[model samples]
Target chain A: MNNEHAEVMEMHMPTEKIVGQTDLYSIKSSTVRTPDAMPRPIRVKAREVNVFYGSKQALFDVSIDVPERAVTAFIGPSGCGKSTFLRCFNRMNDTIEGSKVTGRIELDGADIYDGSIDVVELRARIGMVFQKPNPFPKSIYENVAYGPRIHGLASAKGDLDRIVETSLQKAGLWNEVKDRLHEPGTGLSGGQQQRLCIARAIAVSPEVILMDEPCSALDPIATAKVEELIDELRENYTIVIVTHSMQQAARVSQRTAMFHLGYLVEEGPTDKMFTNPEEKRTQDYITGRFG
Target chain B: MNSLIVATLLLILIGFAYQVGWSRSRQVAPAGGRLHSRPNYHGARVAIWALVPALLILGLWAFFSDAASRAFVMAQLPSDVRAMGGSELAQALSRIEQIATGFGVVGEPAPYESAAGQALREFRNLAFALVVAAAAGTGALGLYLARRRIAPRLRARDEVERVVRYLLIACSVVAILTTIGIVASLLTEALRFFTFVSPIDFFFGTVWNPRFSTVGAGTGEYGLLPLLWGTVMIASIAMLVSLPIGLMTAVYLTQYARPNIRNAVKPVVEVLAGIPTIVYGFFALVTVGPFLAGIGDLVGLDIRATSALTAGIVMGIMIIPFISSLSDDIIRQVPRAMRDGSLGLGATQSETIRRVILPAALPGIVGAFLLAVSRAIGETMIVVLAAGNSPYLRLNPGEPVSTVTVTIVNQLTGDTDFASPQSLVAFALGLTLFLMTLILNVVALFIVRRYREQYE
Candidate 1:
């Protein structure tokens, strides 16, 4: 290998040491042209984000920018903080009584943790689908309609019906359960139940959709179906997904972030990151050197 | 008695035969091929075959012998007494039973007396003969069947399974028969009560005065309205006091409390539930009742020491653990994934609880509430002491109010004539209590069904 390629492969761990030493001129230049080259508006920005759960600190200062109308993927090994950073996007760590998060997070230029913001309203703007399919014991129609009704997104019965139909259509589940919308959501197969949860999240028309290992519980065919839906979802909403499958992240995301032991080891364009990573850890991880 | 013992001996003999047969079969079958089931199973199978039919026949013969044996023995009496009314005949027949069983007879043992003694002697001998014959007949039949089925394809296991199924059905029938018997007796007495007090007067008359003046002219008006009102008021107060505290405590313990705190607090709180209602009764009567009466005096209000408030409060305290435990389980089962899903949506902790946890648990909560209501209504000891004997119709929770259960106790703990309105009133109150509790239980069952539908 050439000296340049070898150097790029080994640049990640020491990148943190250089973070404090980076001159003012270097950071400004590095962050400047990326936004313009990007295809969509910048929707969310994170800088120096660190998280700790009880006595164990999980994420190092991780910075990433999520662009609107595109998919961003977080790929890493177990305990690598990929899902932890994904949770930070939604402030889900708040539920863990002793979890502590410190950083700057801006959604459309407003601090998400600002006293002016309502978490409910913010969550309405940011929907979520879990790793496992979790639909309320209610019917498919009611499951999809719950968010809309709770948030008053649909004020009339006709509006609610349209919302349910359109949400299910968006989730690629309208065909299988269109006739049995009144049937229990749990009565459906595992894959179909996951799709119903997606429909439920979409009923309120969220601006960003965060998925944590969304397809880990799915079979290959169901995973493929969700991948196709993610591609389409990027047309209207920013998508950030945490995944263990490198191929899934490669197939769905435009930008990929690699984490290791709570550090953002690498972040770059997916094609470049896969074929020619700027960091050795990222290269070793994607090539299965070590988990 | 001698023949019953002979029948019992025959039963044991056949049972021993079956056990020996099974052990021999097990030992022999395994030499050529393994036995079809465990050795114990085969032994039990044989014992069942020997005992079941013999016991059924003996029981049937014993039950059917009551009237005919009496008639047969009486037929040997003098002509006038032989045709006596059922009561007189029964009296004479008892004399025969006493003389037969050797309970020393009296009254000079009149004309038919010797005939009755001889008749009793004959009937005893016949019953002994009949019982022994039936047991021997059934046992011989079972032995013959077992011997005929000596082939390898006898499939004793299948026969045993059938027997087991029938036994299970019989056991369930016993339970069902007991419930039906209770309902029938309650209904009969309740019908007798309705003959005196019209349903409307019993339901809505607002007075519960029962006249027990032995004079025939005493016609007391007994109405259920006061007792019904008292029951409702006390139950409502109990529910109001228990619902929020129990539910919130459950939520706190399950969702927010640290492990150490939860472990320490839960058993202490449940200790309240384990206390006997009777203990709570005296506590309410001795402590809360007098304390409240004192508070009432200070406020320039007239309140009895034993009042609805004391009982209701005590009942509420007793039921908190029930509500808390049930709601805790329901909340815990709300699917960790659901909580995760809500949190992942950027919903705050309280927001997620209010929207997801509470909604998911609503059906279960309703079920818990309904069960609590039934428990409160049926509660007796706590109310009997703290709630006074007064059955006056009034809405003041501080005033002494008697519930239906208290009235039932008051009217039934004596040797009064059963025909009196006061004595029969207990059965009437019991029937009303039964119907009310039945409705509450049914409603609670429906709520549980609805709650289960969400998960299933």
Candidate 2:
């Protein structure tokens, strides 16, 4: 585990140095994709998506297809628009002032950004976990119960308790927190808090869960546990994660999309993208040589 | 040879010591070797050493000079005059001091008085000169010793820092000592008051009519309950008016308003706090008082022009900024992640605020409320002008009431003898007010600390 963590750290070292060196304007639209032999049904499709903060463009015409019941990881250097694009899925960017998103995002064949669609319901259907563990400063049970209660997913006390239990169980946190469910979720360890956040997102029964660097703030041991939980969650929920660690993407994701300077450089099955990439930039990034 | 001239001379000497030390340190520096501290630190160390001892000597001299002069004057008096009683001795000493300072006595001075005055003047001038010379000599010695110690290995910065730390401690000690001194004086005066009126009667008595009486003729009822009741009633009413409006205003400013609107409106709201309470008193007396009475007449109610409700509503308006501004800052302190987490859970903005943000910010908001309550309780001007001084312990808000602060003002004003219970009772009221505010502040601090620990 330590060896793997060290390798992940080594993979991230070069990326940190390249920040503020890459000019956004010089990057052209270069997307190389490998067609899957056995294609899964798509859960979410974003097309020609462009994001801007005030007048400064953050994501430039980036598009991707997220397949159902599988993990797709967006891997990039810092400030490469991966998290920005992930936030676009849950419409979390709307919370930011003077932020504008121009494009269409479809979930299950309906435009999520359409005027008729309620943002509350759309967010309920698509939940998000932040870079840091953001469990509400509430009891452990209440943290998981927050979503189910707010979305009216549970009708009775028994139902809410059952929901909280199952969600915690699914996040693999039930055994550790069952006796201390009344305690504040913030008092939990970093790994437990992150799992609790995952449990909170799951309690709402979201069809898709968007995680932005979920394990970035966790230790190596906790990172492995969360990675294992992510693999299990992929069997039921369509998962899209934005990670800085390329090793994490290779380990957990079935498909990997690499973003550079606000542009999607290439995307394919994780194995093919890591071992034999079509784009020279993807190869360089994978081998820790690209600036 | 006055102390001011000595102080000015010491200042100049200290400046010269700094320059001398700087040059000495530079001369003592080894070739191609760095000193332990900069030249400025050495200079500052020397300057501090020069100033502190001189200031101490001057302070000691100033403290003892008056007593020494009085002793000398008494010794020089004729034996017959020296046998006078304490009051006569004091009178004789003042007359001699007046003569010495060239302020002539009421009538022609006696031979002994003139002789004593001349002797006192010569003695004072000689003593003053001697103290000044001693202070200057010790200051020069300190400057010379400090300058000799300035070398390449000398830790001048450390020494200077130690002095600076002591200076800071001295300043804080001064502040704490002042508070302790005020409390001690109040306690003594209040105890004196209790001697006239029993503590039980003053504290638990129902009526509060402190009439002036001659010594040993106790005929006043100094009850605390009525004034305390009035203060509580007025404060409750003020809290009732301010809490909801202040909290809502804070919520609107932090959660709902746009950046432009918040920027434009926040200062305007805080401007309410800067308006003098005296002006608010005037508004309560001239505007709110008459307005409420006019409305009462319309509704066939018998509301007095100067009533608890009028003063309370005006005081509430005056403290609106304290609650709103403090609550605004605290609500904003709730991490943005908490809000995002709630909003991501499919909660509406208001639902998120009501369920999460408000609960998370509840402790701090409660602390703000307590602070505003204390402010309301301590408020004097508004209640003085608007709440009529009935001191009847009435239950109705429409009727005029007198709070502890108003009563204290009433008792302290006019030509009243300080030794009388009527005047000394003001000290007891002041002490009670202080303790009440102090307790509220402590509770507020505890809540705020707990809130901080939970979040941070």
Candidate 3:
């Protein structure tokens, strides 16, 4: 059933690439560029994104398209600017002092960096989960309800309650926390706390959820649970995850982009990228020759 | 002889002992075998043993030398001098001791006194010689024993660590004992005051007219109510002025201010703390007092130049850094992750601070406020200069009212006998203030601990 749907998605997506176009896939590396490869519709598109922190350029001109209802994992070593690019989608970099981002990022064809864009509304549309579990120092229920309450997405107490419950249910945390929802979110285990943070992001019902190495702080069992949750969530949400683990990129992502030294090295179907990467650096990174 | 000379000689002796022990430990250890502890541990152990025994003997010698010399001088006095009253005999002895020390006698001494002065000089020399002999002997014995005990398996490090632990415990015990001594002295003096004035009348009486009663005919009212009320009122005003401004300053420094601005502004605000309270007192008495009176006249309200309002406001300014710095540290400690979590959820910075950061930092902020209040309550110079020291029971802050600290200062500094009710009342008030500060600090510590546990 999923194979048939994927075939239909591939047919609907654009198939041809102009030889000299500036689209994400058309920018050829010396080794390879997989144009017209992604099967799903692009939910977010970044063009020539360059980021600087206090005069030091941390990211070169890099761009990628995040597809809808699919996981696009950015894999790289530490300080490789994968996380930096992910933050540009929701304008999270705006919160960092001395950090400057120059380029265009579009969510549903609307320029996110335009002066008319309200950052608060933009963040509501594109949520983020951190590398570490960062549930607020509030009750479990309140942690889940925080987003909906802040954006006034729920008008009534009952609506907020339902939102919290549905968000927790979607994050696979409702059963474990339902009886003790009033307990402090910090009192939970690390894995449970990360799930609570995930539930918090989902409560807003964002169009895209950005996960920055979400399972990096978790044990293997917890990582498996989060990966499973990610697989289930891709049915409804466009997920863009940045991960240091190549295995995690393989297990959870449908399309994978490898970054090196602040540049997007290569991007293609996850299976093809792992099995037959055209870029030497991408193969080197995935095969653990060197990060 | 100078005490510094003795202390220097003792240190030199300990250094020599360390060298001897270090060499001996190296000799005893097999060339190829590993020693249980480093040579320095052995050296330190020997030095500590030598220094401690010598210090004990020196302390004992110093404690008894004066009494030994005085007793010798007293024995040398004639029977007639011995028959004198106790104070007169003491005076004679003091004069003889003064003559011995060549500090010059207050009056002409009799023949017997002159002879006693000579005998006092002899006794002092004998005491000094005996002290030196005993200290040297004890130090030598300690050095010899420690050097002999230095072996490859001596466990010198453990021994030294044990001594270090005891020394640390002794230092803490000294602090605790000093606090206990202070509280005990206060309790005794307060008990004496209560003997003169009943506790019920003192605690519950609204009047605070402590008349100067020398003959104990009728001790005046020593009511604590008015002073307590004044302290509460001034502290409330100080809190009212400080709490919002200080908390806002902390929030701005922690969350809103840029790094360079925060770095620049934080210390500048903390400069308010470094400005001595006396300076604040001067500002209150000379500047704020008159300014308040001018505003009062403009509004047709009678405000004293030196009133609770002026004092409270100035004190609030004085403690602004105390509250702001502590609250800034606490708010900063609320984990960047917590703030990011809220901000990631689309909450604006202020909303995140108000709902997440402040709530997480609430216990710590409460602790900081309590600490500030305790500081405000115990403050003396500002209140002394500006509160006007009027022991009135009125609730009007514009009226001159005295706090506990100010009243204690007023009662203690006046020319009255220490045994009198007025002077003894200072100790009673001091004890009350100390207990209040103690309780507040305890509660603050508890809250801060709980707050730490929450995030950590």
When sorted by DockQ, best at the front, the candidate numbers are: 2, 3, 1
Cα lDDT tens digits, model 2, B1-456, are 465797689889888989988888899989999999999999999998888888888899879989899888878988888898689888988999999988999988888899999998899889878888888888899999888888899999999999999999999999999999999999999999999889999889999887755444666898999999999999999999999999999999999998999999999999999999999999999999999999999999989999999999999998889999999999999999899988988899999999899999999999999999999999999999999988988889999999999999998887778988899999999999999999999999999999999876
In terms of lDDT, the poorest run of 10 residues in model 1 chain A is A16-25
Off by over 4 Å in 3: A1-38, B214-217
**DockQ for each model:** 0.36, 0.63, 0.61
| Interface RMSD measured for model 3 | 0.8
lDDT of 1 at A252: 80
> What lDDT is reached at residue A89 by model 2?
92
Model 1: per-residue lDDT, tens digit, B1-456?
675686568667667857765765665574567666555556666666667777777778778877766777767787888778688877888887777677758876765776677777778788768776777678667765664454444566777789999989999999999999998988888888888778788877877788664645665888898998889888988998899889999999988898889999999999999899999999999998899899999999888888888888888889999999999999997888888776655455676688789888988899899999989998999899998868998878988899999988888876677777778778888988999989988998898888787765
Q: Evaluated on chain B only, what are the TM-scores of all the candidate structures, in order?
A: 0.88, 0.96, 0.97
- Cα error, residue A101 of model 1, in Å, equals 8.8
Return the top candidate by DockQ.
2
lDDT per residue as tens, model 3, B209-320: 8876654656678999999988888888899999999999999998889999998998899888899889999999999999999999999999999988999999888888
Best prediction by lDDT:
2
On a 0 to 1 TM-score scale, where does candidate 1 land against the true structure?
0.75
Candidate number with greatest TM-score: 3
